[model samples]
Target: MFDGPSSRREFMKAAVAVGGASALSACMSRAEEPIPKGTDDPSSLPERQHAWNDVLVHDDAGNVEGPRHQLLLYVNLDHDGPPTEDDRRVLESALTTLDRAYERSHEGLVYSIAYSPAYFDRFDESLPDDLDLPEPRSLAPFEDPEFDRQDALLHLGSTRADALLEAEEALTGDRDTANTVTMESPLTDVLAVDSRRTGFVGAGMPAERQDVAGIPDSKPVPEQSPLFMGFKAGFAQNQATEDYVTLQDGPFAGGTTKHVANIRQRLDDWYVEQDFEDRVAEMFSPRHAAEGLVDGVGDNLGDSSGLTPDIIESIEEQAKQYGRVGHAQKAARANRDEEGNVRVLRRHFESTDDDVASLHFPSLQTGISVFEEVREAMNGTDLTSNPAIRQRVNNGILEYIFVRRRGNFLVPPRRLRSFPTPTGE
Candidate 1:
């Protein structure tokens, strides 16, 4: 059962980050369990490509447990003008190979492909009127970030480290077959891979990889915390449902828009200068800390982050009395719709890529404007009117995180995922 030294397991996780044929080979040598195979009928898959929660595993408390390993392939088309029919066929066949080789689950592999605004700019037509995907811009006044304008983005996830690496090799033509399914076409045949980003998440993972640039040597990451921060996030009640984020009126009716941000975290102060209660106040709310509502890693809170209407509405008062506001409380202001339903479905995961502590924040919504509004609220600019709150101090977790890059993409429906035009034709 893949048992080995803790160092060996940690090395396997690092191999996913440093992905290649060599890394995949090294990782496969340690696999004890047989990797599961997928169905042959690709047409039977779900319509919405982002509909992954049903396939993912859940904790005893019922919160969706995300895949442990993740890989993002950023690629641009070789030829500029709209892709040829041959290009589409090659891309479709490569993607179909993946579908046939692995089940759409954490144990197998779950993936999605998205297109950028720059990608649609090549076409003479425009996207549907109902879609509100705009070019990404600096959300916070204090920060400037490089925008990712690559033609397309492909996200792959799996609980097995070996499965994740092997999939990468297959997509890039480095392997003959995946899960014993012959790969007739490779994505690299039509698209040029610009860059590859990899990451891991779950209990004990952050702790094992804590010997990185941003974290302190004290090794303070809790064994139960899924993230580098000592708390759980993406509570089921706190997130928008998959249907809520899907496009309803456009030709891409089953599709959604995605916004991804790379946030670099410097947690020396989070571990050394701040105490548990104070950290809770910044990450959650002062009321949560004062009420002793959160246990270690916030597992006691269950499926929700405990941000009720009362807690969210009390942000202004709490900021005035406690001299601080929680990150979730601030964002919850603009996160809900007029019907009081959540707006964005955040599927963020932690990363030790480049030997630095960072978070790859991917939020799915019907429109990019919704994500921008929620992030602006997270900035707590409105709270900064008070003397106690500023851009960084007592506002939220912004003090410890830096926004490095931002990108917005349109995740078309499964049928049109190959090379969809703006009109969905």
Candidate 2:
């Protein structure tokens, strides 16, 4: 079904979204070059599982570029209660096989495994007092999103479609080996995959897949936009450094908390009713639209969104005057700490899973409360006092985006990634 006149990248994206053994075989047949091999020494890898910036490619503007294709495997422990040492060894062997099979880079494979609060509850001991992992819940009053209480979340990302598919097959026991590396064990020996989601992010990717349901038939997604919203995001200046989000003094000190949300996008009104200027106003800030600060897909902004403190401070006045505030503007109010450091690192990607337009949002921070605080600011509940800004209508992109699912997890240090206990056994 992915066959057509589409570019190779586009075809690979389609294959990933419709993943299976057949898709993997077709992807392998289309490979133009051999994938880079991984290291035999697992000790050489970063201690933090979320560490990927050093090896990832960056744009000319110095902004970090995420992998082209991504996959999420939400799995549950095959048996109830705490896991046994044998289970831990089985999972570790399966993961280490992946480490030896593929290079830990965007061109190869960069992945992380995180445990949910539900998974830790099975253990008698509780998490460290300093750690702040929490159960997922709705952040806003208007939305009712399903909570993901799975035992663990395994995130895999790579530029090569075949690499992602082969790694997944190896973990699920579908294949005996990945990249010619024999698998000592498969993850299914200890855990069963409860859900699988796929997504992509890169220039020209969103435009090629705009035929989905939530997007309008006009195909208004920009060819240069990495996201379906026709704009660039993840500005380096606006993002928190990995060190800031990592737990500094706990057993999981080298780790961090991750809040993952699946958001469904309805772009009919976003693209159909609004023009370029209107979108710029709602996406960035009204001042940006008036001063012509943003260009096509916002590549001209460089490493920043150009949201100055004054622009963020004038949100109320802008709402009263322009009758609209921006998505970035509202979120910026609480994104910064008292010392002016960014609080969360957002690693979001667009998706066409289930033939619908959606986004897989992964945010890393020191704690789940920090993410909740930033999300509350994004909700723009306080901005409703301006009368022009209702809960969703003129408050930002809320009108076009709906939260579908939310989950929180503790990304332990690499040493404890395999079915770790709450106390880091």
Candidate 3:
């Protein structure tokens, strides 16, 4: 099934989407070089599991580039109620095997394990009042989304498709060895895999896989665009530092809260009806389109999205003037604090899972409330006061995207990652 008339990149993307032992074998056979081995001492690694930016590669413009391929494994505990200490040890051993099997970088593997609110509910004690994790719910009035209540979410990412597949197989006990390292324990020993979702990001990746649903038949996705929307994102200045998002004072200090959402895109109208200028106007701002500030895929903008405080404050005026407001422009309103520090770290990627164009959006912040505030800002419902902008139409990209699922998790620090209790016992 992996064989066809497709580019090497496309072939790898398909292999990841259709993951299994056969897919791993096919990916390994096509690998051009040996996968890098990881460290013997996992203790030296950073305490924060989300610390991937330092080791990840950056573009010529200095923006951090995400892994080429990524997967999210939502799993449930094998048994009921609270897990035993033996369960923690077994899970930790499985994760340690991965650390020993692959280097902690994009070329090897960058991953994290987070527990959901439901996972902590099994305990008698409640999470500290300071922790802002809450049950997942629909954030906008126009959408109804399913909430993911899985016990845990295991995120695995790598530049090499073979590495990503191998790591996953090893964890699920499908393979005893990962990158030639014998697995002492597999995650499946204590957890049952519930759902698996896959995605990718980077230049040429979106264009290569645009033949799926949601995208138009014209293949209007730019060759250099990292996303199907035909633009670059995750600007350095626009993102919060890992330290900023880490829990500063708690038993789970050095950890963070994560909110993951899956949004389906229907872009037939986005590409067919809107021209480049109109897209720029809606994606950035009307002023950006007027000033000709953004270039192809926005690589020329460097470390920032070119959104000024004035532009963010003028969204109502822009909507009144141009009859449209930009997606980034609206989100920027609540993405910053009084000190002007970005409040959330967005690590979203494009997907062709189930032969449909979608996005796996994972956002990290000090608390889940921060993410909700940002999403509310992105909803652009406040701007709907104007007759020109309704709830979905002309209100950012809401018209082209639909929120299908939402989930909130607490990404405990490395030490507390394995079935952590509410009070971080």
lDDT by residue for model 3 (1-425), tens: 44554656667877899999987897898898999999999688999999999989898778899998999999999989899999999998999999999999999999999999999998889999989999999999989999999999999999999999999999999999999999988999999999999999999999999999999999999999999999999999999999899999989999999999999999998999998888898898898998999999999999999999999998888898999999999999999999999999999999999899999999999999999999999999989899999999888889999999999999999988888889888
- Runs of candidate 1 exceeding 4 Å displacement: 1-5
Q: Which pairs, if any, clash in model 2?
A: none
- What TM value does model 2 have? 0.98
Each candidate structure's count of clashing pairs: 0, 0, 0
Using Cα atoms with residue i matched to residue i, what is each candidate's TM-score against the true structure?
0.98, 0.98, 0.98
Question: What lDDT score is found at residue 293 in candidate 1?
Answer: 85
Residue 75 local lDDT, model 3: 97
**Best-to-worst ranking by lDDT:** 3, 2, 1
